[model samples]
Target: MDAVLSRLKGLTADELREEIIKANLKCGPITATTRAIFERKLARTLVENAGLTEPDSSGGNSAWLDSSGSVVPPCATSATQDSVTGEDGDFGYGMGLNPPEEEALSGTVCPCNVENSQSETQTPSKTAQGSPTFFYGVCPLWEDVLARNERAHVYTDKKEALQAVKMMKGARFKAFSNREDAEKFAKGIFFSVKFPKLDHPSMMEADTINREKANSFKSPRTQDLTAKLRKAVEKGDEMSFTELVWSNPRYLIGSGDNPTVVQEGCRYNVMHVAAKENQPGIVQILLDTLENPDFMRLMYPDDQESMLQKRIRYIVDLYLNTPDKAGFETPLHFACKFGCPEVVNILCSHPDIDKNCKNKYNQKPSEVICERMKEKGQFQEVKQKINEYLEDRLYIPLLRATDNSSQPVIGAPWSPEPMENLSPRLPRSPKDPVMAVRAFAGPLSPSKADEFRRVWKTPPRERADHFHNILKSDPDRGAERVGRDLAHELGHPWAEYWDFLDSFVDLQSSEGLKVLEEYLSKKDFRDRAHEEAGENETSNRFKTPSPVRLYDCLQKRGIFFSS
Candidate 1:
């Protein structure tokens, strides 16, 4: 581990001060203890990842990958692109932190703001209609990890979890050997803010959760089994812990009253159970137990841990490797993406952990750090999963106008400067693309820049000339930003696909829209035009389609055709 980070493990403020003074570092009259911890963490971060011996006045790495999945690399070292971007500044992909992933999913159309206008409330376990929904039934591997943690009852268990997390603190992290083991270990130490049992003991809540959990066919529990596992490991009752868990291997293999089968939550394989708690012996015991016919068919999650154990012959192998072998992600990504930091020390060590990583379209982890911070918008060490990459990863899509109303260009950045000064020709700075589609631009599909114009009227204070000359040059460019805000409104990019599908319906309908036009246009006019003279131009009139056509199309798309 890096020197500073190693010292930062569960440190108090006074210890930090003494360490700073002993090291002979500068910075006068620092007051708060929290600041001391943050300073120390930051210092360790700089020492471990920043490559700069001196502290950065510039808020760490200027450019990084945000949750949006857009790469916001350093844009010329100078600060700020706030002209059109406002207080957030144009870090690159023009969208603000308001909707981080939306900007990234939006791609080039990541600029529009969704935070203020629309009211979106997600009831973590429920659908938008307040109905319930669930995906990935019975994450058996996940439950197993929880069970392991529940078994380990000790403060040191948290310490171990903390230490395990360090391996993932930097760029170029490691992957578990295989899916089963990895899934198990990840689940064991997975971060979660709302413990289902902790927050919702009500029957209604339990019913709702169990309904979802039942999909995995697993048994239910009020609190997670992890606390028990965590305690056992904490105390050194490895022998008792192992015996208690494996006492009836027969039960695991399904000879019990209910029989061992996959469940809805808390799944894990033996290998993962071992790696998550750093117990190679437990893993070996599992392998030994699996020789029975009932356990043989059962598979492990990702196999990295089992493989790691087998090769090195002990759990100690994990500690020996330096930065070269560590696989930490940004703390934000780790916290929110997975939900906890019990094993986070390894991940926060990397430099990019703080980089926004978002482009104009998506949100990076840092924007989250900005949120979890305190009253003045500050932070020391981020703890909550809600604000960052927790089990509660928000999948907010860009807003969809109820009708065919046009939204402003999202990922595209137009200049605040006027047109004549804007260069007479097409703008290459995606921020200022000449959105007008030429005649040859492929027929009005979403990607051809055909739908960039506004379908709605201008807002107050908006100039008509600006709307005409600078804002929009055609109907096609006026109305869409779907491909840009996919993270926000997941249906946007697919909007065109649906449109194309509807067009396919039109093709089959009385309209005969696609066939005649595309067909004759592609025909060798010279070869058959003379013989055909002017038969009907064959493309003159168009036919109208019935709602049934749409119904059929929706059915084909697996949407409820009727009902």
Candidate 2:
């Protein structure tokens, strides 16, 4: 009976799915619409493999029991304690809701399907006086000793075991109120491995922790079978998988409904299992075997799809769109959760899939990808793929301007020097002294300022000689207002550059002095100008001039910096 219970507990979803698929196929071809009905039937056929079988509908013993032959009531067991004073308070064993007809070392009765079988009924035997009897934790005790496991030396009376342990080890130990709790701590002394199975509903409330370890426990046979199937999938043992599936077609639909809490907690289908496991080859085989090529071809009118693409689209629609036990999450969600870019790419390519499908959490699979990227460093590649998919869905590129012109894609604010749009363009020789000075200095070149230095440092006679020589070769041809005339000849954008130059040439003019002072004092002007010029590569060409460089140029012509 223990062996049977172990087997039932060990079944895995993958093994079940394979069995169902094979069982269904054994009958004949079934349409997608009829598949659900067939699958339910398939689940019943494979129940034995899942360790669940119909228990006796008539009450005698529950459908299943261990070899020890102990009968357990359907109601949950509770523990009770009767504390007795000695050197330490020794609590008596708990009593069960029903009186004992027979005693067994270990026993369990599980719910199962109806099957006819009967065991010899045992006559009630009276327990010895002061002997503990098994009882629920909350029930009142009849005698002091409620129950005992000879192997573990556990007594219902907590003080009895506590005194024994204290005397032997010379160390104080906690007193347990029930046989199970007493046995758990004292079992180590007897080198016992078995732990009591007390599945009282109230136990769940006491500690809500879900036992993942309990879920994983399985019988040896089930373990071996599960291993064989998984190994076949891992090794891409197509022959083995095919044979296994053909033999057990019912395993295909076995997992969908009334899912085994152990396997289908995530509500994964066969295909979802394959996708999450990253077994694309196995995935291909499952799709190829499960799908009807003729029906698939009819779904697409153009028939342009290659066999591979056709298979992928079919697989995605068949499996990727289906959510697992977790509501609204598809195979794509599982693939994304695993951070598999290869699987994601394949799923995204399928035309029928909703890349933007939201799960119960109102989150898209791409959003899940973003979250997973933070946990796993390798998922960055997966994140990139998801981002590309999102961009493909959410972003639309603007059309380029069709008109072919020499104009820039994004033109500057104004035309080069068409003050044609502004107030009549101040006369080339304005009446304002500042304007006249700006005009005369025309486009000062920081690089050329050294040439004017010789004139400034020279004697009066030499200065006159240098000035005339300058006039002969200078582009201004020694105009009366050399600065403005030279500036105008240099060009339009240089108006400001030349204006700075005028401050040095016409140093006697109050306006020129003011311009020079302003230029020197406003260091941030150049920074602001550069900022306005912009940092973007497309607009950097419009950057403002460097004030430091311009100041050096002025100082070269004997115009030293001042406040």
State the lDDT of candidate 1 residue by residue for 1-563, as single tens digits.
Answer: 12345445445666756656655665455456456555665555444342332110112223322222222333232233323333222223221101122232222112223531121132221111111111111111222344334322111122223333342221011234333443443443433332333334596665654341211224323122344443454343557556544543332333222122222233332222333444434434433444333222222222344442442222112221111112332223323333233322222322222334442336554433333323332233434423322221111112222343444333221222221221224335644423321111111223222233132233224545544543344334332222222212222112222343333222222234444345445544333324545654333211223345544644443334223
lDDT minimum window of 10 residues, candidate 2: 81-90
Stretches off by above 4 angstroms in model 1 are 1-388, 391-471, 475-498, 502-537, 540-563
Q: Which candidate is the best by lDDT?
A: 2
- The weakest ten consecutive residues by lDDT in model 1 span 129-138
**lDDT agreement with native, every candidate:** 0.31, 0.42
Best TM-score among the predictions, by candidate number:
2
Q: Return the TM-score for candidate 1, rounded to 2 decimals.
A: 0.16
Model 2 deviation from native, Cα RMSD in Å: 30.0
Error of 2 at 63 (Å): 50
